[model samples]
Target: MTMQDSTDLPRDTSRVDSLEDKSLLLVDDDQPFLNRLGRAMERRGFEVRTASSVGEGLAEVRRAAPAFAVVDLRLEDGTGLDVVQALHGAREDARAVMLTGYGNITTAVAAVKLGAVDYLAKPADADDVEAALLARPDALPEPPENPMSADRVRWEHIQRVYELCGRNVSETARRLNMHRRTLQRILAKRSPR
Candidate 1:
């Protein structure tokens, strides 16, 4: 979960009004995660539609724009931003959330600018999704319960740069101003908890 779970939020009887349409589009390349999240959203009273690629998601939006969407940032075919853009273009009031395992500022900003209500890291729970979807537009989201530590954030940044550098240690080190041997050492270790 990126922030607080739905349980942390107060039960709003009027939430039904905001969720009147109840239709949701979920796009993710991960089959198991998609299935699980789809089922969970169904349990939460949404009419869930699942798509595994950007093309499929765009097709679904063209057929019928959903009231809400939870789209993965990186799909097998393309980025989920395409889906979010189509959803908003089809329905101006649609609320979208972008999910990414490779969470970064650039994509997050792009997603929000494209009309997503929130950006969440992957492994987000159903409750977290619900909270984001149902949240009031004027209100701020709750802080994450377990935010990444400084070390973890640094590690993640390094890892992201490494990947961007095509996993070339020397190139990554040059970009990050780190020693090649030190970069290799960091990459060799497991991620911090």
Candidate 2:
């Protein structure tokens, strides 16, 4: 069983609607992540609406532009930069922050060129995201306080490759040049610190 085993609970939107300049759009392919982050942002005074794909995110933006956005760089269907561009087209003043488990220099630069205000590596908290989204354009956001453990970086890289290979263990092993059983063991274990 998972945290999302029950999806019948209703989300309360009344209090969310009453807050102005606090509307947010959160886009990620991971449903549990979107749900958890949505609630967290709401706790910090944001009226949160979430989407799990670039198409859905674009649709949501067309329906209603948000004051802020936290977008996952890689969606199941397409890149989150598409959503950022759409949001900027709808409302140029909207602030957007990009998140990725596979953060790279090229993608970060592309995201910025597409109008995202900031790029963040994943496992980021709502506070970090909020700060980036709300920070002044001229100011540089503070660097990450803690360095990622080498094992954690390896775990994140493996996960990213696994996802890219459509979760196929054999394909991921081939790409990573590891034996199939070794890849399986890594995938089954909890993420390293």
Candidate 3:
């Protein structure tokens, strides 16, 4: 079913619309990422507003009464967790999602306890963000497994080197002290799930 049709969502379209016209408050320190994500969310039928700092985000939340907020863990002025708390304090129904470049179970669990709906790591695309939002209140999805497990650390390191080299196999191999063929073999074995 469409997210709008989900019974778990707030029922009144007018309310949703009123909030949508003002519904989303996106807080991130990275201006470009915020703009990109805001545009992506807008394309998916959300009305998005942005803030570069926690104080500004909190002000916008108080002013707009947004139904949902996407908050980055690190802000220029403070932690996004602070914004989440303020938003929840102002509007109990407001759902908050934490976005971070650094992912850890400790922070994730703490965010949930502080009233965030869920925590998502950076590099997540629009679909990932949407899926997080569409989850039922009692059925939040488990976080994806870390790509840097012990068994996968070597492969993960190779992948990181490859990315650092802009995905050029030869350059990545040179940096990782591995033959190009070896890097390719490791990559081939560990295709993304």
Top TM-score hit:
1
After superposition, candidate 2 runs with Cα above 4 Å error: 1-20, 146-193
Cα RMSD for candidate 3?
10.3
| Cα lDDT for residue 105, candidate 1 | 64
Which candidate, 2 or 3, has the higher lDDT? 2
The count of backbone overlaps in candidate 3 is 1
lDDT for each residue of candidate 1 in 44-83, tens digit (9 for 90 to 100): 8999999999999999999999999999999999899999
Quote the positional error of residue 70 for candidate 3 in Å: 0.5
lDDT against the true structure, per candidate, is 0.90, 0.85, 0.78
Give the candidate number with the greatest lDDT: 1
Candidate 1 lowest-lDDT run of ten: 11-20
What are the clashing pairs of model 3?
Answer: 19-23
Which regions of candidate 3 fall more than 4 Å away from where they truly are?
A: 1-22, 140-193
- Candidate 2, residues 1-193, lDDT tens digits: the string is 6576455778542222332587899999888888999998889888899999999999999999999899999988989999999999999989899999976655787788888988899889987887787676666556668866898888878887887798899999999999999999998998776
